[model samples]
Target: MAVDKVFDAIVVGAGHNGLAAAVELASRGWKVCVLEAKSTAGGAVNTQELTLPGFRHDVCAMNLSSFAGSPFYARHKDALARHGLAFVPAEHCFASVFRDQSWLGVSADLDTTVQRIRAVSEKDAHAWQAMLADFQIKAPHLFAVLGAPMPSWKLARSAWRSWRELGKEGVAELLQLLLATPRDFLDRHFESESLKAMMAAWGLHVDFAPDTAGGALFPYLESMANQAFGMVIGQGGADTIITAMTGLLQELGGQLQLDAPVCRIEQDKGHAKAVVLADGRRLQARKAIIANLNPQLVFGRLLDAQSVPAKYQKKVDEFRPGLGTMMLHLALDSLPDWTAGAELQRFAYVHLAPDLAMMSRVYAEAASGLLPAEPVLVVGQPTALDPGRAPQGSHVLWVQVRVLPARVCGDALGRIAAGDWSQIKQDYAQRVLDVLEAYAPGLRGKILASLVMSPQDLEQFNPSLIGGDNLSGSHHLDQNFFFRPVASYSRYNTPVKGLYLCGASTWPGAGTGAGSGFMLATMLAA
Candidate 1:
């Protein structure tokens, strides 16, 4: 812990990936130190009392859906358990209510889920079974892919193994599934509008259109499958995961410094030597410097432009953040009632896109930098499941609407500069409240406190979420895979020697911080 002591590695950014990387390195006997700009860890996986006293709300990322399937969590569960992390499975995963008052609830039990679907259409219920079966067969390999780095030969080997196990026809079916859009995929199998909408809404969680090419929708469906496998809430909310990771790192002699904003990564002989902090302090390292920051931030701002490769620089400029989202955290006096089941006290997570056409319109309007007439809303009432989050009869609601543009343009920026953005936010919040009221009556009056975070606030809180995009970069085919961040640097290791990338901006774009940290650890271990 000496001020001048050199560590084996220095991890920039205390996000999940940064914590995971530090833990992995420390576990391997490498002396590590993590630098965080924020006083607390858990970048997006943080919980706070943003509203009234006694109301604990998860500011971002409510579900451990991705964490459930993470090999990192599986391997480190014992260590994590000591830090107070636990999981609670919901009876129902999600409920999507249509404009017409029809609803579809995805249950933890596949049979129950099928029955729920059958209420809408028997044929669709059967199709739902087939989809689950197919996913069950393919999920293991898919999960493996998600845990490792992209274009990995190891992953390719697993794919080959799955191919052999599934045979040619099954392989063909998998290929077809990957290529088909969610809209077409659902239409071919389901007849019920509500059932199709529910599935499509789940697929659109990443804020991508169901019709986007290269079938990006598969990952969202895969996310649901992963969640259903081992859906458990962490002990003290998502921050516990970060706290556990930090504890693990500390146990292995890894060091961490909070409120240390890294201004630059100093290099020597084409390799990272140390990080320059904003306070003008230089902390040197001997082995590697891992950046858990967004690729755009790492390359575009933190590293000296003269030292970066021209090609990489171009890609850094070109890298596009995925759609940003508006997060509304509400502290309510009571839980909202659902029409599907009166017994439902909490919505584990709710999907609000009613149908494919509605979803398409939402995407279209968002793409144009305008709020949708009916935005796709994802809601989570963690207090319903974890009463400890609030006082008796109180609840906390986390609502998010994926938006196209992270920043306001000409007129909108001007409006914000002129204090009109507050009005805009109020207007938008009302729209969301109106939707909530229609689906769950008496929701508005129960609000004792609320906080609205614009896209600008999100970027300010986490620079990695550039343009307020939580996904790092768009998951579009052009920006994914070998093309991610840039073509040659998609594997977490960057062009700068001993400097790496590990955030949502890397491969597997966003939602679920499982892949980035695990993959970076694997690469470093190798």
Candidate 2:
């Protein structure tokens, strides 16, 4: 019951961010120890055979475009790559199919993509070219702001540089892009509904809907970035980054303690000193304490009441989690035969949202505690990109139905009864399959086996996915940027001395970038 094990730093939750922190600290000879609640390292990025044997499914996260573009990966690329982490890029990043059997998507080749857009509107094709050109000019400054820590001169300097580069009119356009809705931005540039709908779906991946303010930037970034640099995913599963990061951490002499859920943060003299494990063991930290958790979990549950101020507690209480998501992992006999034709098979993501209005209705209905009639479906056929996932002839489908209420009260279409997720998850999953079969006929028949994780199941799998929100917290205007997690702690430094936050809950929020952790490591090392 009594042990004395001291470390230079203690990192909580062995997610990408937590592992990153451990690796960086150990690289600096900090003698770090990482504590993860789960049995394995990867948090949402874990890979497993959810449906059947040999059918590897990414439980939560699948895309690695953000990770591949991250400065964290950039700094440790060779080391990570040498650890057997391979990335397979998509030829076609994404496609959105319509009820009329027409589809629109973006590919690695600009000419091929332009031709696709030209088929709908020639003017929009030129607009795509112009947008990429502008991105080339503004990307350095834009990404600098996104990646830089908030409440610092680093972000300010980047913004100033952008202002000088863009001048008056260009600055106004940039502001409009940042402030305007996805509908406004796309309608301003492109004339086709498919082009607009195709790109706007990415916003749903975050907190934004098509009409949500502060949504324009996500669509622009995902589309333009994919065109500039192809979308990359782990070769076999999304957990490849986790494997590589764990290897690096262990190689640097850091210890990863699995299945060790930290019950409380032990503080003394207004500084976080150690974490008490669930098994009544206390792991002491001599230097710093890093929490890879949602602010609510860290403050509301783990830390002492007096550890944070009243105002900060109120902010944490007000920390809104985005909409819940339901995951459908399927081991299919073959990939869904999209009615839009064979070309659609090359893409990583095929969105079933027909237009902006449908996406709007889904967000509205879900927020009102009702599952949408036509839920926006992100049908991911990962096996298309990597043929090594399943049996030689078999394939796997990673389907995510967006904008479901965390606690479902009723279905918008009035099909499923309002009840606990345990009772209705299967029915809800069937609803998702209904929509998928509509877009991609014969899809339902191809399923050899399937597994559905409800919103509650998601929360149970990882407490960070509060109310099944994969982004950790909402990415709305008031809660984003300098206001992320909260205004006072936006710089990753908490109110408590030597306590740092690093996770999806922090800035450069969400996805598998490992940005926040890497940034903290860089800051603390300096």
Candidate 3:
């Protein structure tokens, strides 16, 4: 499609958030155009044949539970379904395998989960049931805070309601849980070390280590929610939501330009007026412009020095990114025959972090720029839930090596020399496979092909994943909520008028939640 000289909004980046904001504006009868540097849409939320022709792999994100339950999806569910969006439900949401060759899995069926917990520890099984019972009362209050815009009147209202319903004691307890570390939270709730290990792995999904404060909330929610509502992956790949959103946008008369990167934001008297493309094409925005990139990229690179204050720019510079990740995609002739049991083959995710102590050690090593001796592996069995991702009778594995340094200094094992990513990625990949092969004995032998995406490769694939921080920015208490990107601009508005920020870098960070995008769109359009 030809570029319009002007539009009501010109969104930079064709990421899910950018597309979402565009779709919302277009639906409100505004002319919008989304510009993406890459030929494809979906930044971290993409799927491709990275390994072999018959094997389809979700490049970064695989779980769609967040997107499925998002307010954006809720509002446009029928429209999305009409655009070919579908999900495959998993009765077995996730599990954790131990060095002892035993495993603990969570099933959608509460009774089944209780049984498994009982097999581990009868006391913990009672504790598991107790947590589930409390979840019914607590989840609504927790979701109220997470689903609202940070530091907004809506958030205040949510707090008021929680106070009214729960009274002083309950609200205080909620605050304590929110501030607790993953290990602290687990220690307070359960007795079994393996059970605690199983839950703490949820922390690493969002850059939380076992000892990181403000990490407990994620593990609590994931455990409770999976037990309550089950889990869902996109029918074919994680990009299903992206495809649906783009379809909906075009259906509403919005324009999306691929291979069009914005080089500069044109400003007039401290007001964003237009954007200059990399190809030297100038296009004007009549009303607003939304940037779905990290704040550093936006404030430091895209905008002129005079456009933003020095203090604000410094804050953007100080906005920290979490530890890096390496993605491994495998095309296997058959799924891993787990030595623990074949029952482990049925679940969606099998985490390989053995205990809380090891989880803490890995995070410390990664933070110090050392490759962990034993990195935490999130082994995803998407093909188990959706066989269409691979050829008939074959399977695909999505392995995420979490909590690694973006820059390598040395190896903790002291075997592989410290070098650039290209020099050591294969050796590192083999180490990851060796860790997995211990649990699934013949894992490496069944591989038809494999693709290793180092942190550098991830950044190369999508610039928004700076340093391969898939969450875009850290989710620590100081960097989260109202402090995201920066404390002053937490509501998505910039110092420059008519310009805004959104995406994983904003409040309610990461995953396929679509919270930040939907929240920003509703605010702007209103």
TM-score of every prediction relative to native = 0.94, 0.98, 0.98
lDDT of 2 by residue, 226-320 (tens): 99998998999999999999998889899999999999987778788888999899888888899999988888689866667878888889999
lDDT of 1 at 410: 21
Q: Give the C-alpha miss distance for residue 135 in model 2, angstroms.
A: 0.9
Give the C-alpha lDDT of model 2.
0.89
| Stretches > 4 Å off in candidate 2 | 1-3
Q: Clashing residue pairs in candidate 1, if any? A: 85-235, 86-233, 86-234, 86-235, 87-232, 87-233, 88-233
- Model 1, range 473-522, lDDT digits (tens) per residue? 77777887667777878888888888888888788667655678777876
- lDDT digits (tens) for residues 1-526 of candidate 3: 2333999999998888888788888989999999999899998999999998978999999999988988888988999899999999999999999999999989999999999999889999999998988888988898889888888899999999999999999899899999999988899889999999999999999999998999999999999999999999999999999899999999999999999988999888989998999888888998999999988889879997656898898898898999999999999999999999999999999999999889999999999999999999999999999999999999999999998999999999998889888789999999999999999998989999999999989989988888888989999999998898799789988899999999999988888888888888888888
Instruction: Rank candidates, lDDT, best first.
Output: 3, 2, 1
What are the RMSDs of all candidates, in order? Answer: 2.8, 1.2, 1.5
The candidate, 2 or 3, that scores higher on lDDT is 3
Residue-pair clashes per prediction, in order, are 7, 0, 0
> Which whole-number lDDT from 0 to 100 does residue 372 have in model 3?
95
